[model samples]
Target: MAGEMAAGLAEEGGSKIKMIVSYVDNLPNGSEEGLFYALDLGGTNFRVLRVQLAGKEKRVVKRESREVSIPPHLMSSNSSELFGFIASALTKFVADEGHNALFNDRQRELGFTFSFPVRQTSITSGTLIKWTKAFSIDDAVGEDVVAELQTAMEKQGLDMRVSALINDTVGTLAAGSYYDEDVVVGVILGTGSNAAYLEKASAIPKLEGDIPKSGKMIFEKLISGMYLGEIVRRVLLKITLQSSIFGNIDKTKLRTHFILRTPDISAMHHDGTPDLRIVAEKLADNLKITDTSLETRKMVVEICDIVTRRSARLAAAGIVGILRKIGRGNPGDKHKSVVAIDGGLYEHYTEFRQCLESTLTELLGEEASKSVTVKLTNDGSGLGAALIAAAHSQY
Candidate 1:
């Protein structure tokens, strides 16, 4: 994986792992002060945030945020409709906050956290390379995402400038670095999995022209919340077709793609009842498989465990891969390398988080693992975007 990442960084195309440039040369220095906004659009939900910073002394003095779920239709809708819905949500959030949230008369600046593959043109603009995690807006592909949002904002009479455009992993890295300067890698394991890390500008071979002082690279992963449930569903479906463990059960719900969510699996996996009641409950509730035997419930839990463990182990390997790429995985490296992780999978799924952390430690070995730390930054991407906006503010 480490070698693949290097190859991806050097190659312009055809690499399974795309080490895309983030165009974020600078992270927040913790001295940025003022009011800033952040819009995080990733997966089925989007979030808007406003933050008031008081420079180095106080950090974030005030903050407000709102989360809006995108309708299923919007995920497959045209670019205009999706952006319009997002922009309308942002306008409402701004109006609800009123002028009191403003630090001064300066125009509102926003940092956009777009968690998708993008070919960045600059720090403030990037064209969508493609959509992931269920989004498939055909017209939006190859279009400048920042411009799309900007146009939508204009149509809604919202006055704001997008100062920074970044991936969620980049934002999480920025957020982590704000408090701990040692943080170098950021990983997101929620709806979709991806990682971003700061790399020496000179190391990227595909980069053209003069190299900046710093560079960041992002890559995607398949083992994440968005696909975990579907994986479990497929496994169960295969088992049902091959055996009679389910005993003539209606496979209608099981046949449905994405019918079982990560949360449902997490709940079932964490069931501690003597009878594995939660497992049976989830099977009944989500897959409509009721009156499950204790043995069958155990099998279901085992499946969840197997799937979750695989994902966590793979995620651990990914982190180690990044660490190795950056020359920080060796036992001789005494520097404290902190990996900032965010997303619902890492934050809310206790078992997944534990398995990931433990697997990471195991992969690093006891001696080398002592110098590494994985910190959870809940909603760090959103706050980091706001901070980046402040850092790049036109004041």
Candidate 2:
């Protein structure tokens, strides 16, 4: 995977991994002050947050946020409709905050955390490369996402400036760097997996124009929360057809794509009951499979374990690949490398998290592993965007 990242960075076409430039030349130094806003549009839901910073001493003074679910139809809708809905939600969120003396005096600055692949042209502007996850807006492709949001905000009569444009991984890295200087990489193992790591400007050959002082590269991976359950479902379907462990049950739900989710498998994998009640219940509830014997329940658990373990180990290898690319994976190198991780799979799924951490340590060996740490930054994507906005505020 690391080799693929290098190829993607060097090659313009036909590369699996896209080491796209983020144009985020600098990370937060913890000196950012004043009120800032963050708009996070990742998947099915988008979030709006307002955070007040008091520099290095006070950190985040006050923060409030709201999550709004996007209508299913809007995922594939035109850019105007989708962004307009987002703008309206953002307007309402700002209105709900009421009149704030701190915000009323100045033009509000916002960081847009767009968790899609984008070709960033500047710190505050980027063109959408392609939409991932559930989003497939045709017109939005190659469009300046920041500009779209800016126009939408204007149409809604909201006075806000988009100070920064970033993806979730970059936001995580920024948020992590604000607290820990050792954090060099940010990995998101959520609904979709991706990573961002700082790199020397000269290291990226495919990068065009005048390179900044530094650059961050984005790496998208296939192993993530969004596909884990689907993988398990396919395996179960295969076994059910061949072995019929599920008995003579309707396999309609099992055949349905994404009918079984990561949370369901996580619950089944963590079943500790002597009879594996949770596994049976999940199979019954999600797939309508019931009256499973102890052996069958154990098989289901094993399948979940297999899928989760594979996903975790693969993610670990990817992280190590990043470390190697940056020369931090050398045996004698004692430099501490902290990877700040966000996303539901890394946060909520205990088995996946443990497997990922342990696999990382295993791949790095005992000596090099001692200098590595994986820290979870909860809601770091949104908060980190706000921090970046503060760092680049117009005021």
Query: So what's the TM-score on candidate 1?
Result: 0.86
Which lDDT value does model 2 have at 281?
A: 85
lDDT scores in order: 0.86, 0.85
- In order of listing, the candidates' clash counts read 0, 0
Off by over 4 Å in 1: 43-45, 68-106, 129-139, 151-159, 209-222
What is candidate 1's lDDT per residue for 281-337, written digit by digit as tens? Answer: 888888988888898899888899998888888899999999999999688788999
Segments in model 2 whose C-alpha atoms lie over 4 Å from true places = 69-78, 88-106, 129-141, 209-222
Residue 13 alpha-carbon offset, candidate 2, angstroms = 2.6
Residue pairs whose backbone atoms clash in candidate 2: none
